[model samples]
Structure formats: C-alpha cells, structure tokens
Target: MSDIAIWLVRDDALPLGQRLTAALGATLYQPWQTPGDSPREQFRRCFHQHRQWVLVMASGIAVRYLDGLPASKYSDPAVVVLDEAARFAIPLLSGHEGGANALAYQVARLTGATPAVTTATEALKPLTLGIGCRRGKPLHDIERAVLSALGTRGLAEVREVATIDLKADEAGLLAFCERHALPLRVISREDVAARGWTGQPSDWVQQNVGVAGVCEPCALIASPRGQLIVPKTAFDGVTVAIVEDRPQTAVRHEP
Candidate 1:
C-alpha cells in the first residue's frame, strides 16, 4: 500500500486534490461514510492507518481532530495540513523523522504554496553511495555489504546510487536501487578511468573492466570535489565506497 493518504472535503477541492495525488503519487481518501461511520469517523480511522497524511482542509480542523491521536515524535506518523486554496502547507506533527516536513515541501512545490518547515533535522540531506559487484551477485549481498559499511560510520540514509555504466542493466543492482527509490548514476568506464582510482589497484578488475578499482573510482567521480570517506571495502563479491562532498574543497580521509 502507498504510505500517503489525502483527505478532501468539497468538490471544488477535488481538482486540487487530484493534482496533488498525481504530483505526490498519493491515494485520495474522501470523507465517505460506511454504514454508521461519518466522514469525520472515516478520517479518524484513516489517520491511524497510514504512515503519512495530507488533509486538504483548514489547519484548525486538522488540529482539532488530531488532538486525540497524539504520540511521541518517534512513534507518530507525519502529518501535513494544507489550506483549501493550497496556499500553505504546514507540517502539523512529526516534521523531521516522520517526513512531514519533506512532504510539506513536496506538496508546496506541487500546489505553489509556501512550505512552513521548522524542524532542524530536516536541513540535513541523505547520503549518496557508490557500489560494485560481481557479474551475478545477488541483491542481498550488496545490501548487506553496504549496510555494514554504513553502520560502521553511523550513517543511516542514502540519497543516490552510483556504479559503472556496465552495471546499468545488471538485474540485482537495478532492482535494489528501484526498490529503494534511489536515483542511479551510471558513470561511463572512460569517465571512471579518467577520475582515477583511490583504492588499491586490482589487476583482476583492471583486466576485466579496464579500471584500477570500480567502487572507489565511481564514488570519487560521482562527487566531483568529494574525497573518499570510506575506502573500498569488500564483502562476498561486492565492493562499497563512500564520498562526502564538501561545498568548496575536498578533505582528506584518514587511512
């Protein structure tokens, strides 16, 4: 099921709701009645059911209804409130970890409204990953290797995935990126070679893929000014590297 739920009250709001659903890939929940359940009752049921909620009504209405469903920020789902005219998107609760702040910004972009984001942690962006694998390596192996590498450094999220162009159609890699909704950057072998490798030279990779190392090279090239934060680490047949892009100059990573 899609994690998003949108509630609309009036027919006039339907057009705006439809536009939001298309932009945000959300499911619409009209305040429909089922037997004795009224629209408000249905809204209450849906509020507890979904991971994220977008109520296209006055902010006051959302505040009044959500008063009873209160929980800790760690446990509550993201809640966003939008005006009927779509003029403003306010992250009513769980603005950071729950993703309401991001969702509000997304809704604002779709409807030309102002996104009022007040959460401090929302300012931090997700990390990007560059990876390489054996010809037929399974997805779980890649995932385990990457997760282990990230865990060592206390990093949690990935913004994008990068690999040599040769792996663009690699079934396991492609499926993994798609499943996680990560934008995949396919760097050409020539470009990766030009960037040069930061990791130890691998004669096997040099003979097979014409690169000194696939993971470190791809990661370095993907972030133009970034240096390797995590050097090429191998697990099973997969290799993972991490780079942190600085705003201006690159910083050296300790070996």
Candidate 2:
C-alpha cells in the first residue's frame, strides 16, 4: 500500500485526466487511486485525513484552491501540478521538501510529459546516500558514529566529513576522502560484522581487500533507509549503504 494519492481535475468528457493518472500509476509501480469528480471541499477533507499522500492536480481550479489554502500540517499535501493537457508537468510548492520533485518525474515518465524538476541536487549527477539510525532516530546518531569512526587509525587524520558525501554516488565519497587527508575505507564484513556478517566474502569485499591497508571496525554504518544494527567484534571496514529514492524511503539496516 502506498501512503501517496493523486487528485485529478478535469472536464467530464475528456479522458486526458484519467489517462494521465493511469500513466503515473503504471510508472510508479505502486497502487494509486484518483478521486473522480469530487468537490474541492471533499478533496480537502480527504487530504486532511491522510498526510503522506502526493496529490497530482490536473487543473487550474485545483491549483487555485491549493494557493488559497494556508499551509497547515494536517491539510496541505505534496501537490504536483499538471496542466490539463499533460503537455508539461510542473512541480510547484513542495518540490524537494515534500517529495514533489520525485512525484513530478513519475508523472512525466507515465504520460511522456516533461517534468520541471528544478532542484539543484537532482539536476546535478550526484550520489545520494542517507544513513539512518533506528530507535527514535536523531541527528546525533550519525554525528556520534562519524565522530567515533574518525579516531580509528585509518580515519584519524580525517576531519569534517560531509553529510552529503553519503549521497547515492562514489564521487562524493572520493571527494570527501580527498578533502580530509584520511582514508574512508569501505566497511567490509571484517570491519562491520566481525562477529556476524560472516560467510564467503562477496565480489565487492574481494576487490576492496586492501584499498587502504587500514583495517579497523566501522563504529557504525548508515544508509538512506532507516535500518541499522551493530555487529559484534571488528570487521573488514567496508560496508554497503543505502541511498535516497523517489519516495524518500530510506531503508538503512545491518547485514
């Protein structure tokens, strides 16, 4: 089940609105339903009930309603503005903040429409990795882990790690390592799960066998997803992480 929903406003006779909805649903590969021919008040009431939905509005009238409604935590949804013709897809209000940018792309892919994705991070070819700490996740979780890992022999000389380096790309990591004079060795099973993550090493482990010669256990490993776990003993120092995706679903976990 998706925590997202789509709202389509259209003329009763035209199939453009419904077709666009179908296209977006097909591309997302997730179940999404449209509230057909409903009044604006009813739509607002529906949105108020569910907060995580991504509303795809296909009309100027709906957009007007969206503009007039004051921002409220319980009422405003991540709105995606689609022209009636679906000729162009525009992600206005909640672009990056509300997952609107991703929703826009899905709309484009489904309807062969162009998405007006203006976020610099998405526009730039960058890797986006998000490290998550379960148990009432706090920023301190990542901060403490990085601070703890910094003192390890391999990372002692490193200082000021970029939070964004964890983006879903390698260049970010490489750049962070280069900027800090320290080695950001990949956390291997030996380093991440000396006590557990056992079994024959995978191809990735074999390739990075000795990339840094500094084999120390990673204090913590984080991914975009919110999965996390601490392995017993020391590990190979190379750990795989997860990155952010369309729905902002960060599934960080221990392997």
| lDDT digits (tens) for residues 93-188 of candidate 1 | 998778887688667646656566566553233355789899988878887888887875533356456788788768888778766655466667
Steric overlap count per candidate? 0, 31
245 Cα displacement, candidate 2 (Å)? 24
Each prediction's whole-model lDDT (CA): 0.76, 0.41
Score residue 35 of candidate 1 by CA lDDT: 57
Model 2 poorest 10 in a row by lDDT = 159-168
Task: Compute the lDDT for candidate 2.
Answer: 0.41
Candidate 2 residue-wise lDDT at 92: 63
Which candidate gets the maximum TM-score versus the true structure?
Answer: 1
Q: List the residue pairs that clash in candidate 1.
A: none
Off by over 4 Å in 1: 1-126, 152-156, 249-255
